[model samples]
Target: MTTPFRWDLVTPDRLGSMLDGALAPEVGYLTELCRCAGKVLARGGNGDLVFVGRSLDSMFDLLGGALEGTGHRLARLPLSFWRGYDYSRAHVLRAREILADLGITPASLARRARPVTFVDVVSSGSTFRSLFTLLHDWITEERETWPVIRRKLRFVGVTSESKTSPNTFRWQQHADWTLRLPAASVVNVSLDRPTWSYFADRQRKLTKSFGPRRWIDGPAEIDRDDKTRQALAEAVRLVELGRAREVRRMIARAMEGEPALAEAWLRTLRSRLS
Candidate 1:
């Protein structure tokens, strides 16, 4: 079995600096993205909106905060579905069990009068396709109408913009393969290519290195690296304590280590928030 991924620990001061460097400049842009996503949720009707990955969990918190008083319901349905693996009977059973525990069921879905939107950070979009297939089959087994269910389904994908190409058509094509979701229904949020690429590489490495048990387990069953969590927690605590200036200084110092990333983050902030 492959070893689990782990994050290196850093001092609270270092973590604050790192987070400031990574996200402080992007706050306005990230907040705007959250607001826009919230608006999308609002327009999708009153059905439940489910976010599907840990990558989007923190962003979902921001989005939830932005949607305050918007009368939209949001839930996180974390699951990992990589390609090239046969989902065994036991795996399917466990998935069903997890969904049940999360109160996501055919009956509950049918009760919602509005469309359901599933949000995720999309690379090839295989995870969303696999998850949709699983849920569709489950609903079908319950003798639900496919047409009605199809009509009530929506997807929101966050993707990255290639620095060289700058065109999103390739990503759109990749996501459209096999899944027949309408062009309009698959909302995409584009991020800086290099930043996105760095994270994608890390995710691929982690996925490849994870043990079989982790591969089969529901997302909640897998643990996130404690160091990263601790760092983020401390950063949030500092922010809550109203130490904005200290945070800014720390971030500025950290940004000196990667001026390119700092510039890209700043550019994204200006372009999106302006």
Candidate 2:
């Protein structure tokens, strides 16, 4: 499995962000994003967060920065499960191997008490559905404790912010496979429209799409054009923002209203953040 070529910003391998000094960025969206991140963590019981694909890279970076020194977990899957691929047995095996590396195999799932929550920006929730199918089939084939493993799996979809109503289309409710998971295993966090489009459609990611076609290829090759460079700089800034004391406090405070706040685990974490 080929990994992406992302910079190790935490390690300070780069000299500068390469952004213009004179340009002042409007950052009203950050507060909302921190709230969303906090909700994602609280909803997942603050378990191991594994963001799926590039759409939520900003959130991943933000949380990664905030939780760097803490015991909280953060990771990115980078796997594009957009379907329509005729994956060979070898391809499937390789994909499973990658998942196993992340301690996501059936045995590990059953063994570990902590839930692994996969985060992603969703529209139709096709990516999440495809991922669930893959893991479910693998667990079935391996004859593992599906009952236990299912409980340790979770999904947080970042959907577009909208007016709340009874007719609002929720993907988890519409999906048949969600019935297999324990209640509340699949949840959602919403983002404003502009910010949602920024991540989902406009941002030029530093890594190439890790789709079925590129699994066996060499290290991820990404373009180094001006747009991508600008995006990279913005990403670096987001990471730094996440590391700020106020932002961490914001994250902690944002979890106050979540249902998980009643749990001792979350309260302990909130105390630590404060």
Candidate 3:
């Protein structure tokens, strides 16, 4: 019997569309940047604070070279909300979740005495303000350990966010320097631009390696059972045509009764197939 499941990866395009509605054009630069760097940052990190407040496009360009320069050691924070929802609530909640996953709470930082850098695709100062406030309290409470960890606190934001008020005050007042998009250039394109670009990029690779586009348009709803199965079947067909090694490995893992692995593959299938 097919195992029960009801989740799918929201494409970067979908994420962009969702974000366009949630934040003003200015605040959503980070979201666009996230689409370009999300997969990479999720999979890689370099141990240096190199740039801040740069455009999403420029940030992506720099990600690889910076990693290479730093000997492939880096840390990244890919801020995201729930799938297809880019609300600030989702953003803040996701940020907290990532921090929790890293065990990098304010209180924890004081005790560890490790300088931590916050890196993202966009820096509006607003986003970092809330994040930094949380850190500040944690550092303040743990005065004894503050010195050990204080020097380690750094932030690098890509792209521009509204600089209104004290948004990212710490970066302005405290950070070494904030790298930002140069004036006269479009700092942030429409939120959906990067997402669509990433999808187009992936689609091009898949099309080149396999055959023509067959899914018609992306699925309207992935919540239903039939859609999920239909989606996976399409993915299996494409993977077969492309002989995608990783997809085959996942299919093998699923066949071996690795429920989590199976679910992940299924989710990816749903996303790619859609």
Candidate 4:
């Protein structure tokens, strides 16, 4: 039997003309990012998984929807560990407190003998490295476990492709930095060249339009914006109905209306997705 259409399998190329003029530029970009990210997760993920980060919650939902028939079990650990922030004593204590509250004891993780993949978005990879260290210490000091607990761990990072040197092996660099794990254990779902450039341009524009802090903190603000919420909801509805063609048409029409933005969006998408 043929597999049914799922959002995880959707990519910018597949969206085709739907991304042309049918939806707003920002909406189209967000939809494409979520779809591409979902595709990456579905392709690279293995065994049982724990996904971390608040910004990724929506993308995880898309992934979960696509993974409906797959046997993988997924858990969300909503710990907000900022990449460049200093780790104060209070932060360490709070992390321990949260781990205790979540009942992530060594016994619980080891009970089923299933490997656990840790999923997150990576820039510098400091968050996952810190998490690995914290978990290692906890398993050693509190649970009094050794190599067995460590063996069942894997890390997956969803990141954008490099702009300066587009063909560089970015994942390997990330893997080298992640502690106590083989480079192979780190899986990256990097956005394709066009998508990554488009994203970087958007970030630069947002920063210039607002400020550096606004760019850094945009996800929260975008999430709370009513228009963004509605646009995302509409995109989800279209995917559920398998109306990808309609989405394409909508994007085409929207781009036609705003020729300047449409020109830039399509130009970038063409360079990458083509």
Candidate 5:
């Protein structure tokens, strides 16, 4: 079998700087765009103004000041994300929640009888695409003036994809180095591969790369407990061997079902993946 997709790792300091640089500009970019786009939006002098996407309360607070200044109202779209999960439910709920909050009712939004501004706080733009796609399809079905509504909506914040064309909205990157998989890496992982092998390799590399940071504590400090250390080591192995399914099981077994260890195991996995 081919070797797994091992990341070209960097120190935590380097990672932090990269993340900061990538995400910092988005605040200004969104602020400018919202100011410019506010005029076109149907917010009756209150059509409907809502915030959709991840990190609701924080994004709300950031944009709330500007939105009120422009005579706009605000509603939040709550989202729930999972490890290795793609955007779907979050996208749908955001649109629905906004429509509901505006008193448009689900049937009206579904019917295209009302115009509303769709604002997305995007990190990678996947959720944005998903949201727009649903809106587009819903609008088309009603045989209404879809362009009018589409024109009123705006997407703000960070995206990860490059600008392949004018229509592309790039997700802002925070790290100096973009994580990329080597050309042959996917070949090493397969549905048939045993889970143990995956976990083993991940453990081996992560320990070597990240040093002994706490495995189960505040914002990820290196831990003093042998059990925490052992659990992290085992989790890395599962990931490496394409055994993600078993990593949680192994952690539970090792920690005798300790919640802290379980959380630490997940966070460590996220750090490695992130």
Candidate 6:
């Protein structure tokens, strides 16, 4: 199935009537998103940020808006995978094909210039685990260089903000597959609870969810109803904010405390954002 069409922020003028009375988005929603974006860049090791699903679409828009001319790679992978679900052979094959089309196959991962970091709003992290297991198994089946690909793959989970204590539950630490990658490959960024829940649970979206059931369908149909249009407007506004100089600086500032700030690549990216 074909990917859904998201509005192009570069030519908003072309969408004149669609945006004429569009919903006024909550402009103040940027703080949590921008903070998380900075950490996505800082901890992403200056690599491509691939949003794993629809939940983080707004964050992707925010970054894409601000990264307009910086040569930074930002993208979205629409699959909505879940752990502990059995898949039929046809479904698995189609999923693999989709991954290949996104240039996420073993060969591409091995030759990429920078790492590919997957970002998503996470709860139990079942989605991340499911996607990782598929890729790991596919790499082994293809006999690709695991050692080379391991370093180039990374994951960043956007979790609900919580105070840290030894007893605090951390999803990555409890997942067995995490041991397969380098310790630093799996990291996290937190957003306040209200905003986190809003994104993961209640946000309006323009496209149908691409779960396993929808894998073999025809091209996705975009919904142009009032809700979809309003969602589109909010998304468009996010990109505009990203293009602002002060907003870019704010996102860059969020990176100041990340440990990745020490790396030259991350340092260069921070400079570009600033």
CA-lDDT, candidates in order: 0.51, 0.82, 0.35, 0.49, 0.33, 0.84
Candidate 1 — which residues are off by over 4 angstroms? 1-47, 163-183, 194-212, 215-226, 234-274
Q: How many backbone clashes does candidate 2 have?
A: 0
- lDDT-wise, the better of 3 and 4 is 4
Model 3: per-residue lDDT, tens digit, 1-274? 0111212221112222222222221222333433434332322122233222212323333333322322333333333212233344433444454566566766665555334555544433554554565456545654646545555455544433334574534334442222221121112212254444443232211011110111122112323244333433333333232234443233223223223223443344323322
**Candidate 2: regions farther than 4 A off:** 12-28, 218-220
**lDDT tens string, model 2, 135-243?**
9989999999998888899998999999999999888889899999887899888888898998899877878888876766644666676667777777778888888
Give per-residue CA lDDT, model 5, range 1-274, as digits (tens): 0111112221112222222222112122222223223222211112354544322232233334323323335554432223244435544444444445556443454455324544443444455545455566555655656435443444443222232576653342321111221211111101112222222233222112211121111122334344433433333222232223333233223323223333443334323322
Instruction: For each of the candidates, give the backbone clash count.
Output: 0, 0, 13, 15, 29, 1
- The local lDDT score (0 to 100) that residue 112 gets in candidate 5 is 52
Best by TM-score: 6
Give RMSD (Å) of candidate 4 vs. truth.
13.3
lDDT of 4 by residue, 57-92 (tens): 444554444334445456666565655666666556
Clashes of 1: 0
Query: lDDT value for candidate 1?
Result: 0.51
- Lowest lDDT 10-mer window, candidate 4? 203-212
lDDT of 1 at 28: 29
Q: How well is each residue in 1-274 modelled by candidate 1, as lDDT tens digits?
A: 2223322221123443434333322242333333334333433333467877555544454434433334545666645666867787777666666677657777766665766777776787777777777787888889876666666777766677654555545455665433555555555555555545544454222112222255464222223354444435533443332223332233233223333333443333222222
Question: Of the candidates shown, which would achieve the greatest lDDT relative to the real structure?
Answer: 6
How well does each candidate superpose onto the true structure, as a TM-score? 0.61, 0.92, 0.32, 0.56, 0.33, 0.94
Cα displacement (Å) at residue 21, model 3 = 29
